[model samples]
Target: MKVSMQISFNLDIINKCVCHKCPVQNQSECVRTQMAGLKTSFREIPLNPHKIPKAYCLNGKSVCKGIDRSKPCICGSCEIYAKHQLSEAEPGGFYCIEGKSA
Candidate 1:
């Protein structure tokens, strides 16, 4: 049998994000810390609800194409990404674009 997966894209969580000042030294820990503070069920959605900062969202036309990937993506290790089944390739860097891990 094939395994099924649930995917979610929560703008509510994105809007409530507060990983800006986290000193966890990694995105995964930052996401874990942020999720610990939430009180919602965190259901799954189909779209990529994460938002990118206006400053870094400018890639001539796209919202995250201009980002410097060489800086290392913490999203891969982020708890939020794992919890929501989000991929880095879809949202790309969350720190510079999405205001951190939360």
Candidate 2:
């Protein structure tokens, strides 16, 4: 069995929460930073809680439920991959497992 919850808060929204990669139209580096952050954040979570929150990570690594190759991966060509020492043979591709390409 599974359960879901939705929480929303309104506080004079200021800056638009756009991904850094989306800003200035730097899709490559933006994705790398976002992915790296997601991987690191998830790894920081403790396992004792036994509850993981969803909708947090947005590194663009997640695949569709039934799809094998969801989107074209640019990790191989990304600069972050080389800067951060991420490998292509890792289990989770993109930003999920190994994290950013930069």
Candidate 3:
């Protein structure tokens, strides 16, 4: 049997996101833009559906090409990781590269 689950997105999770500190995010324009956008609003703004940041676990795969996989991931320490129990999902973690959790 196959089960499908929906992931929720919210400001609280984004606020506590550790992606900004992840090694994969170094000097990424995407991350920089997202950071700037977040500062201007507390709510998720889809001014450009293609520009939303964080919540890779919910937003699907990242399109950014500058990400470096050599860096260690900090998703395990994120509050969203524990709250969503993402470790149990297939293709877990590394949402930036592998996309959202299954």
Candidate 4:
């Protein structure tokens, strides 16, 4: 299931995202910096231009190498996840690793 960049980049979605709070996220400094950039001035930038781990629903796979795959995913709890009914999509949950919903 491919989601639009507009819907994925929506502030409401980003704000409600639980990726930053996930245990899988704590190991990556890149994720931290990317999260900070999104919170600061990069919020309006397209997900592809940010060079970050955000908006995986639209941006697909993460470039950051530090992520731990063993940790559980929190995408199931995300507002965007529910709003888009992502559970019906293939390779849905681990956007951080498996990439986008489809």
Candidate 5:
């Protein structure tokens, strides 16, 4: 199960994720702090949801607090959304709080 979860969290998914730019987590100090450390993350190994707070839809709901859900979710425009056909999924796109794209 861990292997499958890790496999789901890949460099390709991370690179394509727009969570870093999303307004939902814009004010999250935790996300910002993690984002700062991401400069060397691509070259490093062993990534987890908290280690790299991206691709929430694929990696599951966020562990960080203070996510502003009042803002609109842009998951529909995401490559991961399209690739996964997330339009039909429940909660549509707010994967950050709604959990993975179920």
Candidate 6:
């Protein structure tokens, strides 16, 4: 049987997220802008899911549409994915396109 858990939207999850490195988001200027924002004021501002470049699995659908869905998801390689048993979640890996895990 598959097991799953609710993912928390937190800095820890953000730190471990691999979505920033995903090929899907590699060409997205919007994602890049958000990454810059994250680097500068991640802790200063309350994190909004719409503003996060990565960790869409814990957050929700991405705000950027430039991401290419043809690429493979690297969630299987993320530390948070392993720790949270995200493989068992519905919609599995493409959280950017399929929305958050559940």
Return the top candidate by lDDT. 6
If scored against the real structure, what TM-score would every candidate get? 0.29, 0.26, 0.76, 0.76, 0.83, 0.87
Q: Compute the lDDT of residue 21 as modeled in candidate 4.
A: 84
- Between which residue pairs do clashes occur in model 3? none
- Model 4: per-residue Cα lDDT over 1-102, one tens digit each: 554334646555656777778888678988777767754554455534346555677667787878888999888888888777788776777787787776
Model 1, position 31, has a per-residue lDDT of 39
Model 1 lDDT per residue over 1-102, tens place: 222223233454444333333332224443344345433323433422233221111121113233443455444554554554444334444445444222
Off by over 4 Å in 5: 1-7
Model 1 Cα displacement at 63 (Å)?
2.1
Model 1, runs deviating above 4 Å: 1-5, 12-62, 84-102
Cα lDDT for residue 22, candidate 5? 89
lDDT, candidate 1, at 73: 44
Itemize residue pairs with steric clashes in candidate 5: none
- What is the Å distance of residue 13 in model 3 from its true position? 1.9
Clashing pairs in 2: 21-30, 80-101, 80-102, 81-101, 81-102
Which of candidates 2 and 4 is the stronger one according to lDDT? 4
> Could you tell me the C-alpha RMSD of candidate 3 in Å?
2.8
C-alpha local distance difference test of each model: 0.36, 0.30, 0.71, 0.71, 0.76, 0.81
lDDT of 5 by residue, 1-102 (tens): 111222378889888888888899878887788888887765667765666878887767888888899987877778877766677766567888898765
Tens-place lDDT digits, model 6, residues 1-102: 465556667888888888888999888898888888876657655667787788888776888979998998899999988887878768788889898888
Identify the leading candidate in terms of TM-score. 6
Where does model 2 exceed 4 Å of error?
A: 1-70, 96-102
- Tens-digit lDDT string for candidate 2 (1-102): 121212221111101222222222233443344445654544553421111212211232322222223444344444433333345324323343333223
- In model 5, where is the ten-residue run with the lowest total lDDT? 1-10
